[model samples]
Target: MGNCGSSASSEIHDIDYGHERVVYYEEADEVQKVGSVYSQPGSKGLNQDAGILYQGYGEENGAFCGVFDGHGKNGHIVSKLVRNRLPSLLLNQRNTLAKAITGERADGDLFQSKQVIKWKEACTSSFKLVDKEIKLLDNLDCSCSGTTAVAVVKQGDGLLIANLGDSRAVLGATTEDGIMAVQLTTDFKPELPCKLLLLYIQFLFVA
Candidate 1:
């Protein structure tokens, strides 16, 4: 649960979460930012959940948001760790890609092409790196426990979404009659037909 806005004060706002720092940028030339977040635990006790909502991601006018749901004994810890780390990892990867592409001469047709490709690459790299780091944590035992992540990034009018596990997202739009809901992702659990087929084949081989 959080809210953020970009101000023209030239000061960087930060809040510490354990050893990690969550940052909010406020600069005179920065883009306008406004958003709020809220969360409530379900009926189950001992909640193990985490989430993020950032109004200015990498560039001005960009946004990033995600939800993490943890399962198993140490699920709470894993969820918090991811919530703290993933955003920074994503921004860093994007910035690195931007720097590498700046030196290359762009063909008019390839200008937007590279930017799109790089953003996708950044998302991929950040996810992999974070997963590896999680596995390497000495104190947390994730052998039978893990977390599901679903994220969305907004760059001006365009959006990029990524998901792992069963979490879902939807877009709401105003229609002639009223507001309508549009689903943006499919459920990625093993119950899906393709995954069920793969699991069945694996069981046969093991038998």
Candidate 2:
């Protein structure tokens, strides 16, 4: 008799993973700036990654701009919201600030759709707009399902960065000093050694 402890063997099977079939549509406009989006493997939605670039001008200001990156499950949604809403919010904020100063809500009236306004004023307005929008998001419970948001504003040759999570933005400049790379955003997760190994296993046996 054969060993009682021995187990019977069946046939072996092979499988093929065709992940290359996935195609994501990315939108970009270059006349003013650049924009791109891509989803990682773990992304459960259309895109787990999102980014944006905005340009603004005023009377005493020129070209004030920003880049925002949103990362997480809802990264794509938040990113889309900010890209569409942030610039408009900034425009309104600028109007509010100008009014705050001169006591006239529409003093400079940059949104008249006429002449270009100053860059500094435009940029300043943008900053206030983004902050207000973020606060609006805070009123609701945005933590359990949250995303990383990093922003950058151009200030002359210098850039200002506001960060909440990981997606990074690096400033590259070449001058008399040479090539220098300045990192703008920092990751929100503190545990560097341990990575979040999220596994989505699907076992299907068609008979």
Candidate 3:
């Protein structure tokens, strides 16, 4: 990995992923201005937003990280959900992705194809469970709490991200558009038509 100082935050951080460097413009608001990814404090949904990033290179295990954005309250729920579970889950499932991609699945094998599908399914199911658990929380300090979540688990040249809400995943691509970047996740606007599908895709795409 590598690091650099920015024209933005005073905090010095070196971001080196051992791959071709990807540039990000990084959008920040007065509040999201904390200059951190997914640091948006949860205001509506579970009072918290959490995310995880796992970089699985060729190593037996991958580099893993998760962030929780707390809303309507402190970062408690987001913190617990990520610190207590997200990391372990990412680690446990990453190898399956690796095997699926690098092993027999490269051929026309439908059986091994299940690995990728399983990964997607697992991530989707996990998000639902997370949402349910957050809703079940009865904290007096956070009765109306809700949280947005994003998680990543990487395997080989493939990366998987799961998300809910506006927290986003953008890809840095070298294109004719001059260091172009695109949002991989759809914004889940609650006021839109088919809000639920958007939300599902939001969670699925880790937006």
Candidate 4:
């Protein structure tokens, strides 16, 4: 894990598992910028948290950011796998959806609606594909190990956010009083009603 600054001329920045890099937009050096990410290892001696920040992602002024939290044994591997592959998979899905709608009338509300639907579909498809890929890994044991993923994609003025498991995404908005934090996604935890119901069903079958 290493840290490097972004150049003023470039809008794109990338950070991987082992190699860490940060990009700041303003002239003054500040940790908090348009493209910045931070991750630290736990007391277990291995960093189970992984993240990515890509500026100029799908188009100019576009960005993609994700944070994954690993749990159980061999979870770090799973988190890294998702972090590395999910972005490309999502982009491909988005592109395919865009191509399919090329001839359609994309203006005003219709265009916005279609874009939202496509992005939601793309995120869903990409996540499923990543899960399948992880399951197919012969060298990895994921029976009791998994990772939570939370990602946000920005294209022009539109923002598409997706979450799986307990990871979260929050948006900081400038309010009249001060900066307000707006949660973008819900954390899917076992304490939720749906999860509790599923657990009860499983326990009944077991008993």
Candidate 5:
């Protein structure tokens, strides 16, 4: 982990996990940006990928990060589109929810009690919307192409994650035996969880 100061209102952080670059965030006044990208590509072809999102996510203390693995013929296109759009979509959903729930409530109250749940809902709706947008694109052919996504949003000491497809997230912790890796999220795949498979089936039907 390393940190560098950009300005009074903003700073950048990088967290390294082995050779893979795991997560990064920038904080500037009311703007926060989160992202992660693998430093190296797969054994096959060139690295066609993306990382992170737009600004104005949350307060200065919060951040959002995501990873995308593109596969198949038009996989690169799909991944890039989602990476570029998901952040705005998520913030939009979160803000809309905030308005609905903040009618007669204090902002700090909502931040203290319901922030994580709010972020979870926002992430879910954003992912679903982005998926639809991908399919609706007139130029892209995603018949056999798709991308795996895993995202995390951090507010103060709280964390919220949303994932789809087969991407995974892990945490490195200090143990008695030195550093240990703990799996934080599952690799959503066809031969894996029954729930994911069912969700995949539902998605297929919906598509």
Candidate 6:
């Protein structure tokens, strides 16, 4: 639902939803040049989808993109909350992790691996924190309302992706024939063998 960039010339639009700050690009051309987004309301008469495209996120050239799909009565609120907050939350988590691993290291595959590990940890921790924040919202009824999130962070030539629920991320690669779409994250459905096993284990413990 929003996009942010580092360009001084880019038009800046700010909208405040309560105390939450939502920043976005006002130039439609600029957003279209980078990527396109589409969301339609479901039969329930409300669109529970939200997305964010952030440029110049962590570093000058870094970017962050995310899509969230909400379900249940308060799905719209949940999706928008995640959309507005997740990018900053993830960045904060990454900075915290980065501070813990300070010092120079040999620049090579090891450096890249370390970067990935830091990002992976940051993403996991941020997601958990977001979930907790949602649960703690006094005005929000989230007992049965939740959103699925799929996000990607681009830094230099590397990409770190995170997914929850059934939302998906895909890569478009130009091949000899044409552009090929490659699926990135696996859908986390309850019917998955791993999920079923975990559920069964929990059920056994309860029984």
Per-model clash counts, in order, read 0, 9, 24, 0, 1, 1
What lDDT tens digits, residue by residue, belong to model 5 across residues 1-207? 222222223443433333232333344555533333445555566454545632334654566667787878988677767776776688889888867566545577655556556666777778889989889989889989988887766555555666787776666678799988866676777776675632221100000
Output the TM-score of candidate 4: 0.78
- lDDT for each residue of candidate 3 in 102-204, tens digit (9 for 90 to 100): 6555466564356557667666665666556656667534455555555555443345666665556666667776877866666565776565343342223
* Candidate 4: RMSD to truth: 9.0
Poorly placed runs, candidate 3 (over 4 Å): 1-52, 56-67, 74-76, 90-112, 132-142, 176-178, 196-207
Better model by lDDT, 1 or 3? 1
Indicate the TM-score of model 2. Answer: 0.45
| Every candidate's lDDT | 0.67, 0.40, 0.46, 0.69, 0.61, 0.69
Which scores better on TM-score, 4 or 5?
4
lDDT of 2 by residue, 1-207 (tens): 111111111211111122111111111222233222222334443443444433333232222233334455555455556655655565565555545345333645543221123323554456455545654775443343445455554433334445554556666657689988865455555575242221111111111
State TM-scores per candidate: 0.76, 0.45, 0.55, 0.78, 0.72, 0.77
Look at candidate 1 and give me any clashing residue pairs. Answer: none
lDDT agreement of model 2 with the native: 0.40
* RMSD to the hidden true structure, all candidates: 8.7, 19.0, 10.5, 9.0, 7.8, 8.7
- The pairs that clash in candidate 6 are 1-51
Q: Stretches of candidate 2 above 4 Å error?
A: 1-46, 57-72, 102-143, 155-158, 175-178, 191-207
After TM-score superposition, the amount by which residue 170's alpha carbon in candidate 5 deviates from its true location, in angstroms, is 1.3
lDDT of 6 by residue, 1-207 (tens): 333333332554444432223344323233323543444444655667777667667853667878888889998799888988899999999888877556635666666566667888888888889989999999999999999888888777677777888888888888899998977777778878675212110000000
lDDT by residue (tens digit), candidate 4, 1-207: 445444443433444445332222222232233555676554666667778776657863666788888888988788878888888899999889977766666466676577667877788788889999999999999999988888888777667777777788878888799998977776677878674212110000000
* lDDT by residue (tens digit), candidate 1, 1-207: 333333344454444333222344433555577654445566676667676666656674677777778889988778778877888898899889888777665574475567767777887889889989999989879888878777888775567777777767677778898988977766667767564212010000000
Score residue 131 of candidate 6 by CA lDDT. 87
Comparison by TM-score, 2 against 4, better one: 4
Model 1: worst 10 consecutive residues (lDDT sum): 198-207
